[model samples]
Target: MKKYLGPILFFAVFEAVAVTLWLTMDHLFYLFNFTYIGGSVALGLVLYIRKWKYARLMVQLAVGLYMLIYLGILSRENMQIEGFWYYLFLGVFEAATIHYVVAKIAGPLLFGRGWCGYACWTAMILDLLPYKTPCGPRRKLGYIRYITFGISLLFVGGLFLLHVPDLEKVMFWSFFIGNALYYGVGIALACAFKDNRAFCKYICPITVFLKPASYFSLSRVKNDTEKCVSCGKCKTVCPMDVDMTDNARRRKNGTECILCLKCVEACPKHSLHI
Candidate 1:
């Protein structure tokens, strides 16, 4: 029961938040757009104090609610079939605003993309999924983010250079289709390749942007090397598959780190203190 509890609780929270947002769309719009300045305030607090865990959870909840409102459910209503290009622009703008600007800039600079671990709708969903891999020898592949970044640039640049009006139509259709494909592919790869977060490391555009920004964050997971036992529990529990033992020994945070604090939580000898 303890083994399954984390994933189950994650799902329960996700569903509760998603359903609540779905039911209270108007209130969310008011809070997110006008009334609530909580996010910015929270960002400042986290940055000033280096409160990684609290900050991460707040941003995560905010972003998760935003995603539920914008992409998961409400998006169906807002999508315009007739003015496809206009709708595409709206969608792109929204994604950039939330993922790149808000999450990447405010969240990462303050709390090191803790939102990736705590708040992202996709990440939250992924966290709930069952894993077959016994946490084992983990490796860091930070280069994969660069590849994803290049592809995102190409996709955006190609559309701009080609002056493709149909690009909007294509992307509009892709909103639903692309999301399904990403999740489907992520699940398949996780099951087959045993990479717990293959999509996050290899394909998420938000991650591509956030990883670089996170380097400057004041709130980061740091390891104490001198405390010493190199048991690899931290590495195995890591969804991103970063070797926390290696990170602790080296006294450096791996770029692939999502700042999930699973490593901090899993450390037995108190050697892998974050």
Candidate 2:
């Protein structure tokens, strides 16, 4: 019962904020966007400090589902903005700037990729996905984010350098189908790969963008090697399949980390610190 208190309190706070935003704002869908990222971060902070698993999971589901509905299925107005060249430039610039600032402040100063664990909308959805993925003994899969990052960069750059006047027409038609496919494929992959956050770990372009930015984030997951019993709970609970123990042991920071704080909460011996 004590374990459930923190989550319940956090959920109440999150819902209150959402209702306030909805009542006050003209564009309620925008609130959905803000809630997914902003609310997740706030909840993650509470969970990190309080070590509440249920609260973390609750925030994960609420924020993740809202994002899917808003960004993926409900409307294409947001994606429509991408059709304009200036809007596209500004959007990518703003996104990159936010990613860089948040990552730098969170990664080095406070916790490594802690932002990814809590703040990323993509990670939020991946967290709610119920399945387990195979954790291979090797660390080769960690490089997938780097490849994704490169591809996103190329896509953004191609849009800027190549003057494609018909891009918007193409995008307008593609948006609905593309988003549906994306969500469908992501959910299917989650069902297939039970252990890891299949979509977040291997496919999300947003994660690719956030990885470099997270390097500069203020917070990070820290480990107390001495207290660690090597139970591997942190790794088991990790949606991204990151070996928190290995990461803690090496003190090596990577862009793949979402900073959801699951590893911190999962450490039975309190070996994982954030």
Best model number under TM-score: 1
What is the per-residue lDDT of model 1 for residues 200-266, given as tens digits with 9 covering 90 to 100? 7666666666766676765656557787577776766777655556643233445566776677767
Models 1 onward score TM values of: 0.62, 0.60
TM-score of 2: 0.60
Model 1 accuracy (lDDT, Cα): 0.55
Cα deviation at 175, candidate 2, in Å, is 4.2
lDDT (0 to 1) per candidate:
0.55, 0.53
Shift of residue 44 alpha carbon in model 1, Å: 18
Error of 2 at 64 (Å): 3.9
Tens-digit lDDT string for candidate 2 (1-274):
5654544554554455456656665447534654556556565556645655576556556655554456434543333112223344656433224224434333334445544454444556555665643444333454665665465456546865887666545455554554565567677866665534666666655555455545554445667889988887787666565566764433333455666666776788988764
RMSD of 1: 9.4
